[model samples]
Target chain A: MIPHDEGNGTSKPHAPRIGVVFGHPSRQYAPGEELVVRYDVEGVELPAIRAMERTVVWYTEGKGEEDLGVHRFERIDDLAGLAEALPHGTITACLPASPLSYEGVIVKIRWCVRIRLFFVAGRDFVSEHVFEIGAIAPARGVVERVQ
Target chain B: MRLPPFFGKKRGHRRTGSQAWGSFGEAVFYAALVAAGLCFAGLLLTGAVGIGPESAAPGWMRGWLWIFIWLIPGALLAFGVAGVARTVRDWGKSEERRAAAEGLGTLLESMGQSPAAQHPFPGVPACDDLVNSPGTILRYRLPIESPESWTLVGMGLFAGLWNAVLVVLAVSAGIDIASGRIEWVLLAVLVPFVLIGVTGIVIFIRRLVLTTAVGTTQLEICDHPLLPESSYDVLLAQSGSGMLRSLVLTLEIEEMASFRQGTDTRTERVIVWRDIVKEWTNLEITPGVRFETHVTVAIPAGAMHSFGSGHNAVRWRLVVRGQPERWPGFVRVFPVVVHPAPPAESAAVRHGATADGVPG
Candidate 1:
């Protein structure tokens, strides 16, 4: 049973609202700090990967901070990609709305997000992380993977 | 009872030669302090050579400046020494017991009787695709006998210092961030990050301090995202030294990827671990990586899983399966803070409990 989308509708602020200091793919949040946003005020522990699965879909209202919105954080790995994947961490998806700060998830989410091991080469050959874009794609930002 | 003049008199300690080695903790403290002293002296030597603290200070001087630098190694060496001593001591007793048991069995056999000892460290259910990555240096489960102070101190000194070193580097980087003058020498900040390794060494110490009271060994396995079901061997042994009484049993447990499991929920005992006697520790296992491992006690006919003072608290012997031979075991003990049960009302109170979060 897929869980419902958890976005705005409640009075309390969600956890911490995240913002970008001008759009830059390589830079946004600190290396270890998390990017958080919510529909309500209470701080909620963000759910994560389940069993190292390839992908997960979060349902959100896709609205700016001013308006009530819903969004999703698909295969978003790390803060930079997390912020870049969604221009403003927005996912345009609709589902039967339910409870909590997090919208309902369909499959149990993968607990650990695997990031590309950049710089040190001789790994998976691909210089870009285009493959991950589909999972973390904004309404736009979709790119092709070149070998 | 007139004895030789030396009989019960306070005697000189047993040392083959000179200088008795200091206890593990003291030795570690000395080693760290000595190393730091040398580093400081090296800096001063450069100062003597007309070099000032500004640019005159060499790279080694900066290494000694991290937080809790000496305390880390000192604590770790103490902890590690404690663990090794305990292991060695237990190792001796196990050998002795086996020898005595064998001797007894032989004597009884001559008299036409069977006085056999149970097989040492019975086998456990074999796991499928057990993984020990290159990243994992060593892994083991707690035996009936846990390692002592030096062991933990050694582990702590190493692990804590290692982690502390990293924290120091990160902090220093954060400090250096303001000026934005990080001289990255071709992917090398040239910063001596050996301290980071030092911090990791003291990780065990931090763990010891964190978990001493909460529980006797740390819940190590089954926490990693892609966790494997593992078991360690507890070698049931007898001491080789005949004079000592009280049997010393050493059970080793190692980690394995996956073990034998029932096809479905129809069977209650899903996972099983066979001991040296071939007796199995069966688990009512579940499907995923998380909840497949658990500690379940047989509830009395009318008992429910409850906890209050002593009336409701459930205390059961938890036997986690491990491949003891696969890796060396460590008993990392530390002081821990125990918390009262969460209020019944707030759902958010519990984070990582059970397969849902943490095991109660």
Candidate 2:
């Protein structure tokens, strides 16, 4: 797992540290292909983790209201289950065919895996890792020709 | 999934005391409206109000007054119900979040199922409705985005309603004149209304004539859910009795983006690319026959497939523009969908050839 920092400068010393590793090194996938993700948590105990959620979703960004679609989701609250998954976990899902990752002039679609940890004190921390879904080339802005 | 917050402290970060107090105050206000509505309804239904037949008013007028009075409770009840529903929905969302935080829901693993399978391409429009109608020569007929008949009907309705008001005003003025009492204000108003009514009629007539002369434009395609780098046959049919100066068919791709600006939401669309597919000049059509022709349309090899989301879209359309000999020019649009290209291996297999263009 590659460690990732939350980057919240004010976070306490005991705040959780999370890392995620994609199955593929390049983090790129084709349509109908399986995407594998593994994540690890550090500096946080299992008992203090009231709940945890893992999700894979695609969302739109840019000059429009954001739209999202969930591809996979799981929640765990059992302390024993949390302990088993605390240090490390693996998730696999088959990506959808459409809505391939697009980099357009005004709109873009992206895929990401989110890991959220809810502590006993009612505070939650989320970590996100982005990956590409398809090999479509980026779009170019059109130049208008006056006739 | 999340559970209701009926039993625990609210989830998420703690808020300031004042913010909590403000929310409590708002809830109380809505609750008070509901209580007031229920109390008023009970009083009205139980005949607690003093309205009766003994009131000093005619029976017909009293009936209207009772209806007007009942409106008070009706409006209150409507507002109260709407407010209650909104509150419940909001609370349910909060509870859902709490439940999620508590990990009380079942696992929702959409492993093999795609977003398209569950929601039919969440943001993209379903093409079944567009492809429902059959065509004469092509496999499917595309419906125009906007029909001109609706515009003609709107114009007619506006002209009819405006003239009706003008007639009522003219009769009122005539009655005043016959009584030897002239209301110059009413006469002056009549002058503008008469001019406006005449202008409305003239405009409506011109639109009607233009619509009848330009007729309908029908586009038919050989296949749908088009693939990139593929060519398909399209049929164009125009029906009307006139000399069309020029008819041009063009393929266009447009980008649409919507954003919220303060209190208002604005949507902007720009035609990013356009290519003229075919053009005809000096076409004559009889009333009984239509002008029909077939053309081949090819999607560029590296074109972007059609995409749609809640607030953004890349759309493809075929537009037909025609300028009649005497009437105004008209344009009709037909929307189409372009799906992503198939994998190279699948394409090669289907085409009975190797990837390098050698016979298999």
What's the number of clashes in each of the models? 116, 1
**Residue-wise lDDT of candidate 2 within B56-97, one digit each (tens)?**
898889888889988887787788778767655554122224
Per-residue CA lDDT of model 1 for B9-37, tens digit only, reads 21111112111122334455545655655
Docking class of 2: acceptable
Name the fnat for model 1. Answer: 0.00
Best by DockQ: 2
Report residue B183 deviation for candidate 2 (angstroms): 4.1
Q: Per-prediction TM-score, please? A: 0.17, 0.75
**Model 2 chain A, poorest ten-residue lDDT window?**
A1-10
**Residue ranges of candidate 2 with Cα displaced over 4 Å:** A1-15, A142-147, B1-122, B147-151, B178-183, B241-245, B281-289, B301-304, B341-360
| Top lDDT hit | 2
